[model samples]
Target: MNITVHRPGDLTSADRAAWTALQSKAHLNGSPDLANPFLSPEFALATGQWRRGVRIAVAYEGGEPAAFFPFQRSATGVGRAIGLGVSDCQGLVHGPGFAWDARQLLRACGLVVWEFDHLVGGQGPFETGASGSFPSPVMDIDQGYDAYLGHLRERSPKFTRTTLAKDRRLARDHGAVRYVHDERDPEVLAILMGWKSAQYRRTGRSDRFAHPWISQLVRRLFHTRSDSFAGILSVLYVADVPVAAHFGLRSERVLACWFPAYDPAFSRYSPGLVLHLRMAEA
Candidate 1:
């Protein structure tokens, strides 16, 4: 096996295609989380453009690409998952039956330590490196939205009734309520960021958008659209006004729930929950 390192933004079109192919193939191995959009080359590239040190290590066997490791390197030879702290999914993406030593890959990339959080499944080699692990909540709607709602209603009938009643009240008080699953408006994204930032400050937590690169990266990603990866901005509107919004990334199989916020004036309507339910239904 041979390994080569390249800046995420510098990867050629061929490289991007191969990377996407490997991830898609990996999804076939019963690890659908491998299909998360955050693991896609486009995400790495968008993040690389706004932040320094983003790199992808491509490993080849028999002159064919086999695996991809995307990370951000520190000055002291430490590595972290690309778009760390924000990316909900992380880990190397590899084709079936491809194997390589983690240490060797690290050395090839000139890193002494490679750290990851929320690492997706199918990473047997890195399992020993983990000191702790936790379950990542994922909404499984493979059986269809109707089945999911049925299950939700069965499990949380009270919660479901409350949420539905609030949705009705929201519509009654503020005109018809509607949901947009894939909103393409850039202005809506800006509004979501502002709401998220305010929510952060209100909770005494530091705002993620306060960092210029994170903000720019998000703005740039909003424009990125592809078959395997896309920026999804879902909004809940009442009387043509957005009461809640969520910006997330989507791949073929997975919809990563990222930033979610709502207009505080509509808190009684539980707009955020309504937006999530509508997003899931869509």
Candidate 2:
């Protein structure tokens, strides 16, 4: 067994494929949603380009890449899960049976300590670092949109009906409804950024967009187009004007919902909910 560390941008083209395959095993061997966008080589690549100290440790067993651990390291030896706040799931992408000493692995990465929140279960080495865990709400569309909606219909009939009715009313009252998934127009994304900032201030929360780095990261990610990971900017339009929108990261099969906001002028119609529903279907 061996561990090879490299800056994200230094990764060879072949390393990306191996890392992606290892990530795939994480999904197929367990929950499909384990295939998080943040774990994709694309995320690491983007972050490496945007910031310094981004490192990835590729563990090879029997001369083959077996696992991947990506993190950002401080000069003082503190390490954090890559893309921490924006990443929904965090972990070393490994085969189901893979296990290693957490401290040893951290040391291999030249880290004295490692920290992570939202670390996925089934990770053996990092178990000792976990103080506690919390449940995060996630929509499981593994059964496809219709099947999941069927479950929603049975579970919350009124809620589902009301949301759908509002969707219809929104379309009728406005003009034709146009839900664009994977929208690439930078102007539309700028609008989403504005709406999100206003909402954060209105709700008395710290606006993340206020930070230049955070804003820059999103802008950099917006241009990322890869087979395993890409930015998904979805917009809900009424009468050809943008109403609600969400920007997220997705692999071919999994989507990590990130920035989601809507025009408050249309708040009465609950455009955010409507946009989410459309995103799920797409």
What is the lDDT for 100 in model 1?
A: 79
TM-score for every candidate vs. truth? 0.97, 0.95
Candidate 2 whole-model C-alpha lDDT, 0 to 1: 0.85
TM-score of 1: 0.97
Question: Residues 41-155, candidate 1, lDDT per residue (tens digit)?
Answer: 9899899998778899999889988888999999999999899889988998887777778898899999999888888877888888988889987778899999998999999
Where model 1 places Cα greater than 4 Å from the true spot, the runs are none
Best by TM-score: 1
Q: Please give, for residues 81-161, the per-residue lDDT of candidate 2 as tens digits.
A: 887776677888776677788888998999999889889867767977799978767889888999999999999999899
